[model samples]
Target: MNEELAELAASGATALVSAMGTDLWQEAKGLMIRVLGRARGSRHNELTVALDRASTAARGAVDARAVDYWTEALSRLLDRDPDLAQDVMALASLRIPERPGNVVQLISATDSAEAFAVQYGSQHFASGPKSRERGERP
Candidate 1:
């Protein structure tokens, strides 16, 4: 697995901790740990497939809030690297939307690290209050 991809996966999991709640966040974190562990011995394609499945399972078991966070992060990832749009689409399909209309769509997207940062920042701002009030400051 590419180091960058590994980092992204880890960061995505961390982001989920806030985007979703602690319970779901812990699940996401577990998935990331599995991914990271397998990555040490697997190839890129293998890691990708594992991540896709993990994301799918996580999405299915959580609320739309989790899916939304995953989708937004994935959308920004695709946007920054159009080459990854297919991967994003694949992962999106694995996601089982708690709400039928919560699926994210990516078409001819371009990658922008700055855009990802902005989107993530906004999401953090929106979800932070609830997390703080609940005393889950991870």
Candidate 2:
């Protein structure tokens, strides 16, 4: 499997899972079904039932493995239709909403040295009630 394609599957799966029972659920499900193409027909009812169950489970308390289950399902679909990788990725990207306005970030390190540090996506950092000086360590 293509690494990038696999990554897209994983990401798209998470988005689909998160959007379950939301306004985006139908849209995501449609896109996912289309991506599945002919294979979808064979598993149409099965998939629908699974998605509904997932949505119901999500609506309740919490299911930590929901994302993983959805990711695996999406991955299997991708594996079945390697040709739809790009289209699936495009659909996945569409599910991700863009953030408007300026984004701010604050990063702090204390008594630690590291190489190749990287961060992605929206994040926030707020100082606690008690402020502490960051001292450098030799």
Candidate 3:
């Protein structure tokens, strides 16, 4: 599973759950089904029932439990078909309307002057982050 894709799924789930109680609920559902691609016959009926039940439970509240459930659901779906990410983002953006921005950070430190590094994402570090703090690139 791709970390970036997982993050995307989480974000999309938050937006989808948030939109559940809005006038755009049907639109969101349609987008999700479209992402599913094979939502037809019994599968489609099952998804419709599940989505309706979730919407009723949400009832205009940003429920944490609902968000968590949808996050895992979307994560699993994306795991199966990563190509659906673009469609998921389309639905998410429609509801969330986020500003386009991202942040990258890296840190390095340890006790006893030990050589250690703590980092996430793609960041190159020198032998010590001290050089990085001084605007040196590794």
Instruction: List TM-score per model, in order.
Output: 0.26, 0.54, 0.58
lDDT of 3 by residue, 1-138 (tens): 899888988888888887776777778877877876642333446656677687567375578987887787777777777777898888778754333355565555544233554343354656543433443334
- In candidate 1, where is summed lDDT lowest over 10 consecutive residues? 112-121
Q: List, residue by residue over 60-127, the lDDT tens digit for candidate 1.
A: 33455544555444444434444553343332233322334444644452332122233212445544
Q: What lDDT tens digits, residue by residue, belong to model 2 across residues 41-60? A: 46657776776676556363
* RMSD of each candidate relative to the true structure: 20.8, 10.7, 12.7
Model 3 whole-model lDDT (C-alpha atoms): 0.70
The Cα local distance difference test for each model comes to 0.42, 0.64, 0.70
Ranking by lDDT: 3, 2, 1
Off by over 4 Å in 1: 1-61, 95-138
Q: Order the candidates by TM-score, highest first — what do you get? A: 3, 2, 1
